[model samples]
Target: MSRMKIALAGIGKIARDAHVPALMASDAFELVAAVTRHEPPEGARGFRSISEMKAALPDVAAVSICTPPRGRLQLIAEAFDAGLDVMIEKPPAATLSEARQFADMAARAGCVLFVTWHSRAAAAVEPAKEWLRGKEIKRVEVSWKEDIRIWHPGQSWIWEPGLGAFDAGINAFSVLTHILPGALTVEDAELRFPANKDAPIAADIRLAHAHAAPVLAAFDFDQRGPQTWTIDIETDGGRLALSDGASAMSVDGEPVRLDGGPEYHLLYRQFQALLEDRRSDADLRPFELVADCFLLGRRKLVAPFEDF
Candidate 1:
């Protein structure tokens, strides 16, 4: 099969850090152009906007959107209407209705629409899932805390209404959704919003599973030291723990390594498979849980956070 001609709609942090590097390394895709307000990187056509790219590079078969979560519906609509497949970053949309809408539009248009949950594609996630296949979980705990200044310095969208705690927390949900044998529903959530920002700076979420005890999660955007992204679970049989956002895991103190590395590369491989199969994979479980966390969770105002 020929390499798919792909363009990037937004060339921000994740795009530079993950998508561009992954595409450069993959034989499945040909990086054709980048649509961004900033100068596009070398080896790809640069356009100030998607409109210009669509007009000039009509042959580009697919596009990966790495923009902020807000104002994505219009972009998705236009891409699908132009007969190009789309791959979206996590928190695909700000609302559940839009998620359903995008999935439906992709299905009706017969274009591959992939919603990537990078954390789910992490090295240890599948192995953890296999390890916990049918074990009865006693309790589950997810802890994700990182410094926003170090990770997203000056990015105003982090403090915006659409994505804050949900941005990072959804990654936790993604890994959890992939590994757990059964489903979970949000029992409740406690969100800590900064007084000056529209989004929350910290989150305490509760989840319920039919076969498991209460699942507790803590997501915070204010951390001073080395980052933490982990999921620890106690099952009826033994204990399982994932560290470094599913990059590594341990079962009863035994270190387990996965077969691969760098989740974005694995994500592109799956995108290639989706295009070849002429199908779309836009699972909404994780996003829906985020929505549920916002809708059903309690909100508390904390001291305002001032980022660098």
Candidate 2:
């Protein structure tokens, strides 16, 4: 089969670190162009906008949008208008209403739309899901914390209204929603906002399922030491833990061997499969949980997060 020509819509950190490399290595897709407001990556043909890219590279079949959530709705719409399939990064849009429109727009255009939750593609996620089946789960604890100075650096947009700690917390939510046995609803939440920023810097969220097992999550953007992205589950059988962003797992204190290259690689492979099947995978469970956290959370002012 011929490789599908695709354009990357944003050339930021994730684009450079993950998406571009994945596309270049994929057997099913080819990176033909880039659409960025800033200078594009070296050696790649650059375009000012999706419309311009479509006008120039008429043969580009799909676009992978790597832009921030606030501005992605319009970009996805433009791609659909140009009769192109789209694959967007996590935390799909600024609001649930806008994210909900992506599927409708894709359907109207007869194009494939994939709102990817890349963390769910992690090696341990599926294994943990399989291990938990038929077992009685007693509790779940998620600690997703990282230093903004390290991960985001000078990216001030992280403190924007729709992002912040949940930008990283949502990845844990995505993994939990994928592996858990049932649905979860936010029971209570405490959001710690920096005095100077519009978004929260740390949060404590409590969620519940019908089974009554408590789900506790702690998220922080100000950690100074080693980062943590761990989901520990206490089940009747034993303890199941996914650490290092679900790249590693252990059950009953024994390590589970994992096999995979990178999350983005798995994501593109799934996108290719979706395109082949003419299906759209826009799972909204994780996104909805984040929205609900904001809805039920009480705000507390913390020290001003003035730096990166």
1-308, model 1: which lDDT tens digit per residue? 77889999888888998999999999999999998887786799998766678899888999999988888898889888888899998779878888889989998888999999999888888889889987998899999999888888789877778669778989998888888877888988999999998999999998986644889999999988999999999998799999998889999988986687788899999999998898899888988888889889899999988887
Query: What RMSD does each model have against the real structure?
Result: 1.3, 1.0
On the 0 to 100 scale, the lDDT of residue 67 in model 1 is: 86
lDDT of 2 by residue, 127-230 (tens): 99999998887999999999998888888778888658999999999999988988898999999999999999999999985459999999999998999999
- Candidate that scores best on lDDT: 2
Model 2 TM-score (2 dp) = 0.98
Cα lDDT over the full model 1: 0.88
List of clashing residue pairs for candidate 1: none
Cα-based lDDT for every prediction: 0.88, 0.91
Where does model 1 exceed 4 Å of error? none
